[model samples]
Target: MIKDHRPYVVKRAWLKFQKFYARHFLRPQLTRLGTGFTFMRPWHVELFGAPIRIGRYATVIATPDKKIRLSVWPAQAGKGHITLGDYCLICPGVRISSAEGITIADNCMIANGAYITDSDWHGIYDRLSFGQAEAVEIGKNVWIGDSAIVCKGVTIGENSIIGAGAIVVESVPANCVAAGNPARVVKRLDPEETFTTRAQFFADPAKLARDFMAWEQAVLQGNTYFGWLRHLLFPAKGD
Candidate 1:
């Protein structure tokens, strides 16, 4: 079988567009996009001066309606850091505030309305609130569900799932699925789930890409339109 460089080429081309836009259209216009992160419509909100390092193939989408509020700590005024590892998918409505530092590792999927904060943001006492808060570290291959809130000083381990509508108050270990208010570990994900199998590879990067291209071509050829027409004409298999 021949090695396909098309995917690599396509990805690099898109990365170029991302870099150009981040420097020219976004960074000067908005806040910071950092290095190697792709920001689509970052103008809607403000990400603090904290080094928002987005790894290769990581995406942060800030929509028109959703705005992310990032807090910059005075102690960290000169230096603050937020690092996201490779292939991390941050959906719309994700907000991260780092008064100290926050690290999210590779292949993590964060759904909509997920908020992560490393600091208390305000001092426990109003006077101390301005002081430096602790840092947060989220390990690799984590999935944070929609509308979940991860509070200050919490570290989520690798291969864990934070259920939708959960509020994380404490640290969670690897290979667990946590849910509910305050977010407790309900189930453990199998160790095998952490490693990608051959089927998964084909289903994700390979087949998914082919399917998308096919869908685009189908639309161009009116295949989808005619298929819908045929479906209306004959309610064949199942209603």
Candidate 2:
């Protein structure tokens, strides 16, 4: 019986090429690029239609649009303008519409499928609302979980976390965990540890970079392709 060569060849091709980009080029680009951090892959940055400004040490992992619902308008005036602060982590499948402006402060962790918009885009009563909208500001150290929708004109205070699938319609105070469809405060966080800004982290670049690299190694060690490839190319001395 002949071995299945197709699958093996395909696997080798992917492992040799695509995996390297995913591990090195993609990950590093996402990790190192700031206020405007982006993945080199178009799918990773498709909905990022606007000119995004990412601060220092920010991570943005734009995921594939499996459902093909991403529409990044080319209108530079107000179509998409996303601002992310320092030490921020934006996961995959996060859809941010920028008919208006969207501001995310320092130390923010925006999880998968998190959507934030500054405008209704289509107007409240009519479909043809061709105009810029209000800006949404997410304060420092805010952690927005998966599938959270932050609507227009909403201000989320510092050190707050929006729980998964929450739809925020109003302003939330500092040091609180907000959740639900029309997101509300679920719990309050400690003042000391709650609100941390990007200005705080990048104050020491050397220390911050060192710490972040170490953390990245620990978090993505076995998960990254490089780690696996290294193991495959050079087995442990004792193993």
Candidate 3:
């Protein structure tokens, strides 16, 4: 029995096209975007308010229904700012809004439905009055779980893990796991323990990308343009 490799080739071609579109169209809109930024569905990622900077090899995944929003609101004293460090991964339904500032350090992985805000948006008593704005800092190698909320004036230390559905209202110490309504330290990670992050994958992204393409070509060696067309029109049973 012959293996059908057309679907893989078609998928690879589509992804390459998306990457090209993202680089040419989306990169220009950003205040500062570093090299090798990959956007999985760039149309669903929204950015507003300037002075936002994202570092090299960052990957952002978004869908039409679960858009990833990064916004900064202007303040009377100082303007809002957002800085995302190298090799960060931001998943779908993640929103980062800043009135003062928000800084996410290198190799941070923000899970789906996470929210990071630096302002309350409005005062409790004074409906018209804007609430206090503060800086929110997320340290290097932090993992923010799904549906977590990191509120104003919060600082999550390096190597800390914010559990799923946690609401972080206070500072979290380094190398610890936090969870619950108001996130607190649940467990501590060993100081000497070493773990891999998204940074490792991006260290030599170009070479890895080339190798991937080469492998794909080898796998789809006998696949023709006609096969790709057929795959597009009438996808396989499992597809």
**TM-score per model over all chains:** 0.70, 0.63, 0.89
Off by over 4 Å in 1: 1-20, 27-39, 68-74, 77-79, 194-214, 222-239
Best by TM-score: 3
Candidate 2, residues 146-204, lDDT tens digits: the string is 88899888999988889999999899998899889788898988886634465575677
- Which stretch of 10 consecutive residues in model 2 shows the poorest summed lDDT? 1-10
Give the candidate number with the greatest lDDT. Answer: 3
Question: lDDT by residue for model 1 over 1-239, one digit each (tens)?
Answer: 12222333344456567567666755553333444455666565565564566666556677888765554443546545677777777788888877777888878888988998776666656865555477788988889999999987789998889999999989999999999998999998887754652224334555666785675444444324444455556546552
Residue 92 Cα positional deviation in candidate 3, in Å, after optimal superposition: 1.2
Q: What is the C-alpha lDDT of each candidate?
A: 0.70, 0.65, 0.89
Which residue pairs collide, candidate 1? 122-129, 123-129
Q: Which residue pairs clash within candidate 3?
A: none
Error of 3 at 202 (Å): 2.1
User: Which digits, one per residue and each the tens of the lDDT, describe model 3 over residues 1-239?
Assistant: 24554756576877888798778877776788988888999888888887788999898999999999999885655668999999999999999998899999999999999999999989899877668888999999999999999999999999999999999999999999999998999999998988888888877877989988888778878778787677768787764
Residue 171's lDDT in candidate 3: 98
